[model samples]
Target: MIRGIRGAVTVTENHAEDMIQETKRLIETMAEKNQIAPEDIASVFISITNDLNATFPAKALRLIDGWKYVPVMCMPEIDVPGGLEKCIRVMMTVNTSLGQKDVNHIYLNDAIQLRPDLMKEE
Candidate 1:
């Protein structure tokens, strides 16, 4: 079976280093929480708020040890009237035996406000 894991993170600024680090952190957390392997990932879709133009978040995936071949695409998020800023969202599709309900969704930094209900208290 294939499953989609959703994740979001916010960068303090629009710097390229911040974008790369935060995106990598978000993806790593998502994979760790869901026990996903790079080889099992089908593809990764990323969207960043219009305010973020420093760099492409997909660059983070390529820097991962085994994710060089994982298909990844990046685009700009819809700019709503009062949408969140400097936020990066990710949707990772992977081959897994886990059920939909068992999948874990990750939200970090200021992006946690995007999905408080899905977050489990630590």
Candidate 2:
């Protein structure tokens, strides 16, 4: 079966280093929390808020040891009124045996507020 894992993170500024670091952190956490192997990932779609345009988050994925071959795409998020700023969101599609309800969706930093209901007590 195939499933999509959602995740988001916030950066302090629009610096390329910060964007790359935060994106890597978010992706690693999502994979770790869900026990997802790099080879299991079918594709990853990342979107950053209009306020953040320093670099492409997909660059971080290529830096990962086993993720060089994984497909990834990055784009700008829709600019909505009152929307979260400096936020990077990701939707990773993976081949897994876990059911939809069992998948873990990660929200880090200020992005946690974007999905309070889905946040698990840590």
Query: lDDT per residue, candidate 1, 36-119, as tens digits?
Result: 999999999999999999889999998889898999999989999888889999999999998898888999999989988888
**TM-score, one value per model:** 0.97, 0.97
lDDT for 114 in candidate 2 is 93
- Which 10 residues in a row give candidate 1 its minimum summed lDDT? 113-122
Candidate 2: segments with Cα more than 4 A from true spot: none
- What is the alpha-carbon lDDT of model 1 when measured against the actual structure? 0.93
Q: Which pairs of residues have clashing backbones in candidate 2?
A: none
**1-122 in candidate 2: lDDT tens per residue?**
99999999999999999999999999999999889999999999999999988899899998889898999999889999999999999999999998888888999999999988777666
The alpha-carbon lDDT assigned to residue 99 of candidate 1 equals 89
